[model samples]
Target: MTDTEIRAGIAEVARAHLGYEGELLDDTSLVEALRLDSVRLLTLVAELENHFRVVLEDGDEAGIEHVADLVAVLRRRIG
Candidate 1:
């Protein structure tokens, strides 16, 4: 998938997981914007893996801060 498509997929998974009713911006901070706790983080990771069929790197788990980070990570893995 292209980067835009990857980001869109990530946003869809995030919105579904968080029950968010609005758009997820590129710069939205995951922790501050979504208040993602460990369980929710795990769910997001699992869903991303299932949705993308790509395994996340350990660095991704630790480094993701904004919605864009997911795009960067997946772009590297799948692009």
Candidate 2:
């Protein structure tokens, strides 16, 4: 998938998992914007992995603070 498609997929997963009703911007902070707790964040990560079919290493968990970061990681893995 292209970067845009990857971002859209991740955003959709976020919206669904976090119970967001409105649109999500690319740069939105998952913690601050979605108010996700640690458990929810971990859930989001698992959902993204399922969506993208990519295994996330423990070190990779550090860079994912926002939707943009998630998109970036997906892009790198998909590439």
Candidate 3:
């Protein structure tokens, strides 16, 4: 799928699982923008994995700080 589709899926997962409704830009900090606690963050990750049908590495979350980073990771995994 395209990056735009991945990004849209992320937004949908965030909204459905985390109650996040704001716009997610490339530079948008996941922590700051989503106000995510550890549990919520994990939930988001799990939902993203399920939504995208990709198993993210344990280290994947470590490198993700912004929406773009998550999109990049998913793009790589999806490919």
lDDT of each: 0.79, 0.77, 0.90
For residues 1-79, write the lDDT of model 2, one tens digit per residue: 8778887787788777877666566777778776778888788878888988888778776767767777777788767
TM-score for each predicted model, relative to the true structure: 0.84, 0.81, 0.94
TM-score-wise, the better of 1 and 2 is: 1
| By TM-score: ranked, best first | 3, 1, 2
| Each model's total of backbone clashes | 0, 0, 0
Question: Model 1 TM-score?
Answer: 0.84
Clashing pairs in 2: none
Q: Model 1, residue 3: what's the lDDT?
A: 75
Q: Once superposed on the true structure, which residue ranges of model 3 sit more than 4 Å away at CA?
A: none
Greater lDDT among 1 and 3 belongs to 3
User: Candidate 1 residues 11-50, lDDT tens each?
Assistant: 7887787675566677878777667899888888888888
Off by over 4 Å in 1: none
Q: Tens digit of lDDT per residue, candidate 3, span 1-79?
A: 9888989999999999888899999889999988889898889888988999999987877778999999999999999
* Candidate 2, position 29, lDDT: 76
**Which candidate's lDDT is highest?**
3
Scored against the true structure, residue 16 in model 3 reaches a CA lDDT of 93
